[model samples]
Target: MSGAVMDEIVMDGLRIDGCTVAFGGLRAIDNVTLDIPGGTITALIGPNGSGKSTFVNMVSGQIPPVAGRVVLKGQPITGLRPDRIVHRGLARTYQVPKVPKELTIQEVISVPLLYARSDRPLPSGVRSAADLAHYCGLRPAVTTRCGQLSVSDLRRLEIARALACRPEVLLLDESMAGLSLEDTDQVIGLVREIHVLGVTVVVIEHVMRIIARLCQHAIVLNQGRLLAEGAPQRVLTDPDVREAYLGKGFTL
Candidate 1:
C-alpha cells in the first residue's frame, strides 16, 4: 500500500483531475482522477472499451478530455500537442505498432532520438538508440525493415523507440498483447528495467500476468469510472473489480 502513494518529482507530477470523455451521450471516461508517482510503474486495467485507452489518450495529448485537467510536474499540460508533451518528459506507445513501413528498425528508432537530442555532450544519440534497442531485446531486428518484423518484434521496437525519446514518464498500451510466453517474459523484464532507471510508467494491459508481475500499483476502470485502485493483488481480488470484469463466475 505504501508503494501506491504518489512520489514527488522535480517536475510537478502526473495528475488527472475529474477527467471525462464522451462520445455522443455515452461517457467513454467518466470523471476519473489518477496520479502516477515519479519513477514507479502503475498499471491501468479493465475490460475492453472500459476507458483505459481513452484515459491514456487524454493524458498523452493524443486526444483532449472534454472535462478535466491534466497536469505534469505542477504545470498544466492539458490539451498540449503530442510533440510538446514529449518535450515535457512524456512519451507514449500504442496498442498497435505505428512504425513506418519503409523505415529500417534502426531508422525508426533513430528518428525519435534525433528529435529528442539534447545539447548535453554524452554518447551520441545513435549510441543511446543502440543501447535502447539492445536493452529492450530488439537488437536482432536492428537492421530489419519495420514491415519485415513479426508482431512481437514490432512490439519490442515500439518500446525501444519510446525509450529513445528519453522521457521521464511513458504510457505503454497493450505492449504485451498477442505475445508468446517467452515474448511476454521479455517484455516484463524490459519494463522492469525501464522503471529501475527512474522513469515513471503507466501501462494499460489486459494480461493479468503482466499486471500481477510488473505493477506495484493498479487502477481499475469500468464504464468510464474508476472502480478500484490499490496494490495489484488486492485490487484484483476486489468485489467491485471482479464484478466489473469477471461477473458471477469470478472467484479468488
Candidate 2:
C-alpha cells in the first residue's frame, strides 16, 4: 500500500478511553485514555512499572480491561479474544519473542498468513510466508528453526508473524530490548518500512534515541497514568517525565 493510499484509508486508528486494569487490588493501568492516529508512528514510553506492556495487552485483548473501552476504527473491541482482535485489524508482538523452538521461521510466519482474515488486503509486496520473512529481514534464516536463531532474528520473526495478520495497527512491545547497536539500527529500519506500508505503529521502548528517531509522537506513562505526551523531543524533556525516570531532580 502506498503511504498516500494508507493515509486516505486510515483516519481514526485506535482509541483507549478510561481504561483500567487491576491485579489483585493493584491497578496496573488506571483509567488512562489515549488516541493513536492512523498511519503514524507513536511511542509509548515510561519507567519500568509505568504499565506500558499492560496497556498494550489491554488493547490487544490479552487481558481484559476492568473499566474502559478500546475502540478500533470506530468499533468497540475491549474484551474480544486476541485472534478476534487481530481479525479486527489490530495485532501486537511481545517483549519476549515466543515461538515454537522446533518450528522453522517460514512455518512460524505462515501460521498467521494462512489464517488471518481482514477487510483490507495484505500489504503490497507481502503475499506469501517467504515474502513476509524477507520483509522482516529473516529470509536468510527462513528455513532455520526458531531455537537456532539469534536474538535479533527471533525478534524479526515475531514481527513477521504480526505483519502476516495484515493489521491496520501494530503494537511492538520492546522489540529492541537486547539487540546490539547495529542490530537495533536494522530493526529500526524495518519498523520504518512497516510504517510506510500504512500500518499505524505503537512502539513501547525505553531507548530515547530510538523513539526520537522513529516516532513522530510520544506518550509517557508514570505509575499507570499519563504523565506527558506530544512530539518526541518535547515529551522527553517534560519535567514530570524526566522525574519519573530519574527521580525528582534530573533531566534527560
Candidate 3:
C-alpha cells in the first residue's frame, strides 16, 4: 500500500478503549483495547470465547460495555442503540445473517435504506430494488424469499443490507462460518469491494486464510484479553497467539 493509503487508514478509526463486558460472574471481555483505522480492513481473530464477538457487540451497541467506552472519529458512541449507531455511520452483520423470512431479497435490502441516516447515502443512491439486488449480487434472487436463498447468498444479502445503511464503519462477525471455501471467497471478494469503496470493516473470523486475504491489520484476543495486534503475518505468528489459538503444535 502507498504511504498515502497507509496514512489514510492510520489517521482515523474506531477506538475501543478499556471496554469490558460481563455476564453475571463471567467476564466476556476484560479491558480490551483496539484501534480500527479508517479506510482499512481489520480482522479480529481468536479461539471461541476469546471475546471477539463481545468486542464487536460493544462497538455496535447490541450490548453495552460494563466499563470503558467506544469512540468513532473521536466521538464517544459507547452505549448507543444499534439503530443509533447505524445512523452514526457504523453497521454490522451477524454470524447467521438474519433476514425476515417473510421479506423478499429486495425488501430485506431496502429496509435499512429507509431507516439509515441520509447524511451518508449509498454510493448508487436509493433506487429500484433491482438496483440494490444487482449491486449485492442478488439479482437472480430478487424476488426470492429470504428463507429460500442459500446460506452464501444470505451472507451476501447481509452485506448488501449493511451497505444500504451507508456506514463508514462495518463490523462483520463470523459471516464466513460454516461456508464452503468457494463461498467464503465469494463473500471475501464482496467485502473487498466494499472496502475499496472506502468503508472500514472489522471482520471477526477464525479462518486465517480469509484474514490473510482481506485484512490489513489483525487483532488477537484470548480469554477476554488482547494477545496481539499488527499485520496478520506478525500477529498470527506471535508465540502467545499460536499457543492460545493455533495450538502449540501448529505452524503457519
Candidate 4:
C-alpha cells in the first residue's frame, strides 16, 4: 500500500527540509530536518523548551517556519494555512484536547465532519468516528460533555476527531501527558491501531515509555537541535540524550 499513490495528495513520505523557527531572540527549531516514513511511527522527544512542540507546530502549520520548509509527498507545504494543510491530508492533535465545553463527545467529533463536507449532509464517516471512539475506550463517555471528560477520554476524543479528517499523516503533540499507567497503555494501543489503518504518525512526547513502545524510529533533540536519530533504544541511550535528561550526573 505504501507504493500505491493517492490522487491529488502527495504521499511521498513527510519530510522537514532544514526547518527553523524562532521566537523573539531565541531559536525554537534550529535548522532541523527529519522524515516520517509512510506507514511508520516516528517519535520526537526533548526537554522543556527543547523545540519539540515548536517544530511540530511549524510542520503542522500552526506556526510558520523562519527558514526551510515542510514537505509532504514531495511537495512543499511550509507556511500554508492550517485548513489548507488539512486538505493536504495532514492533521494534528494537541496535548490538551481542544474540545468545546458545551458539546458532547459525539457533537465535538460531528462538527468537524460537517465542516469538512460544507454543503452536503454529514457523511457516513460520522459513524466511523463513533466506532473509533469506542475502539479507543471512549464509548462510555460518548454522550458526556467535553468539560466532564477525564484526561484519557479527552485524548481519545482528540484522536477520534483527527481520524474523522481522513488524514494520511497525523501529528500527535504530547497526547499521553497527564494520564495514568493503565490509561497510557490504552492510548498506546489505540495509536498502534490507528497506524495499522495506514496513517503515518509523528508523535512528540516527553514520556519515554510511550515513545519506546510505539516509535520505530526516534529523534532526540536538545536545545532546539538534533542530538540523535536511530532506533528507539539506541537513541534514548545515546550519551547526548542522557546528558540532556540528567545534566552532568548522566553517565554511561
Candidate 5:
C-alpha cells in the first residue's frame, strides 16, 4: 500500500460500510452496508437465521466486523471499544433480558446509569431510578426482584436499562420476543413514545404487526445480504421479498 489517505464523508447518522462477518466457512453477514438516519424509528425484520442479530451486534460494537468499517458522523468508530461506543451515544438491548437475581427493578436501572458517561444525553424520566421504572410501566413492582418479575416486565426493564445509558441511537434486539398480544402492543407503543422523546431507534423484531405499526422505513435481510430496503409497506410487499422471505401469505 502507498502513503495514501482517504477522506471521511459527513454522514447524518450511523453508517455501515461494507461490513462483513464470517464464522469458519459460513458468512454470517456478507459485506453488508447501510445507513440509519438519526431521530427516526427504523424496523429491521427477517426470518430465522437471517443475520438480524449479527447486524445489530456489529453496529453496537459487541462484535467487530472482520472487514469494512462502521462510521458515526464522519468518525471511524469501528476502532473504538464497546464502552466507548456507548459513551459516544450508542446502546443496545438484548433478545433476552437478564439481571442479577438479587437486584430490584430500581437497582437494575441504577447500575447502568452509575457506569454511564455523565455527558451522555439522559432520556426521558431518567432523573431518578424510580422515575425510569415508572416510565417503563414497572411502577407497580418497583422493588420486585428480577427473577420475580413476569417475562414481559423483564423485557420492559431491558429498554429502561438501555435508556439509562442516555444513548442517541438505541438498538432493541427482539425486545418483544415472548410477549403476549396485549403486552406486545403496549411495548410497541412504549417504543414509539421513546422515539418521540428524540432518540433514534432501530428495532430487531419479527412481529409484523408491531413493525407495521411503528416503522415507516424497513430493511429486510436474507442470507446475510441487503435484500430490500425502503418504505416498510412497499418493501414488505415486493415480489422478490415476499417470495424469498415473507412467503406468499404476507401482503399489505
Candidate 6:
C-alpha cells in the first residue's frame, strides 16, 4: 500500500483496540487491533480457526469481548447488543444466512426497517422493502418465500435485510462461500454496488481472487493476531502471510 493510501485508511472509521475473545480456556481473538476505513471495502482473511469470524462477531456485538474496545465512526460500541449495534450504524451478514424459511422476501426485508432506531436514513434510491430487494438484485416476486429461494438468492436477501438497517458499515461473513464462479461474480458486483452507495464494507472470504478484486485493503489474521495488512496485492505476497494463511508456494 502506498503511504498515502495507508494514511487514508488510518483515518476515523471502525477501530478495534486490543480486542480479545475467549471461549472456555482458548482465546479465539488475541489482542488484535486494526482500522477499517470509512466508505471503503476491506477483506478480513485467515486460515480456518484463525479468529476471522470471531473478530466479526465481536465487532457486530454477537459476542462480547473479554478485553479492549470497538469503536465505529468515533463512537465506542464495545459489548453492546447486536440490535443496538445495528442502531448505531453497523450491521453484518452471516456466512450462512439464517432467515425464517417461511417469511416472504418482502417480509424479511421489512424486519430491520421496522426496528431501525438509527437516525441515519436509508441510502438514496432505496425507499421501500421492494426497492431494497431490487437493489440487492433479487428480481423474483416479492412474495417468494425465503425457503424456496436458491442459495444465491438467500444470500442476496440477507444483504438486503442488512441494508434495511441503514448501516454505515456492513460486514459480510463469506457471502460468496459455496457459490459458483458466476454467482460469486454476481456477488462481487453486488458488493461494488453497495460500496457505491457509501457504506463501508468488510468482507470475510477465503477466496483470494474475490478479495483481490473487491478490496483495496486486506487485513490478515493468524492464530488470533494480526499478521499483515496493506494493499491486497502487497499483503498477499508477504512471506509470513502466505505461509500462515495462503500456504507456502501459493500464488495470487
Best by TM-score: 2
Residue 206 CA displacement from its true place in model 3, Å:
0.8
What candidate 5 gets wrong by more than 4 Å, as runs, is 1-10, 246-252
Instruction: Report the Cα lDDT for residue 56, model 4.
Output: 72
Task: TM-score for candidate 1, please give it.
Answer: 0.90
Misplaced by over 4 Å in model 2 are 1-11
lDDT of 6 at 124: 77
Give the CA lDDT, 0 to 100, for residue 82 in model 6. 89
**How well is each residue in 133-168 modelled by candidate 6, as lDDT tens digits?**
998889799999998999999999999999899988
- Judged by whole-model lDDT over C-alpha atoms, candidate 4 comes out at 0.79
Model 6 misplaced regions, further than 4 Å? 1-11, 246-252
Candidate 3 lDDT over 1-252, as tens digits, reads: 899875555447898889999999988999988788888899999999998888878788988999998988777898888889888899998878767898998888778888886576565554756676677666465888998888878887887888888899999988889989877777888789888888899999998888988899999999999899999999877899989966878776
Q: How many backbone clashes does candidate 6 have?
A: 0
Which model, 3 or 4, shows the larger TM-score?
3
Estimate, for each residue in 1-252, the C-alpha lDDT of model 5 and write its tens digit. Answer: 232222221254678899998888889899988877666789888888889999988888887899999987667789578889888888899887768889989898887788878575556446888888778777557788888888888888988999888887889999988888888888888898888877788999887778888996788888898888878888777787777664777754
- Model 1: how far is 63 from its true place, Å? 0.7
CA RMSD per model (angstroms):
3.1, 3.8, 2.9, 4.2, 4.7, 2.5
Clashing residue pairs in candidate 4 (N, C-alpha, C atoms within 3 angstroms): 12-73
- Candidate 4 lDDT over residue span 131-236, tens digit each: 6567667956677788888778888888878777767788898888988998888888878977887778888898887888899988888888988887999998
lDDT of 4 at 114: 57
RMSD of model 2, in Å?
3.8
* Top model number, lDDT: 6
The models' CA-based lDDT, in order, is 0.82, 0.89, 0.84, 0.79, 0.82, 0.90
**lDDT (Cα, tens digit) per residue for candidate 1, span 15-128:** 888998888999999998887766668899999989988887888888888899998877888888888888788888988987788888889888878886543222233366
Task: For each candidate, give its TM-score against the true structure.
Answer: 0.90, 0.93, 0.91, 0.88, 0.90, 0.93
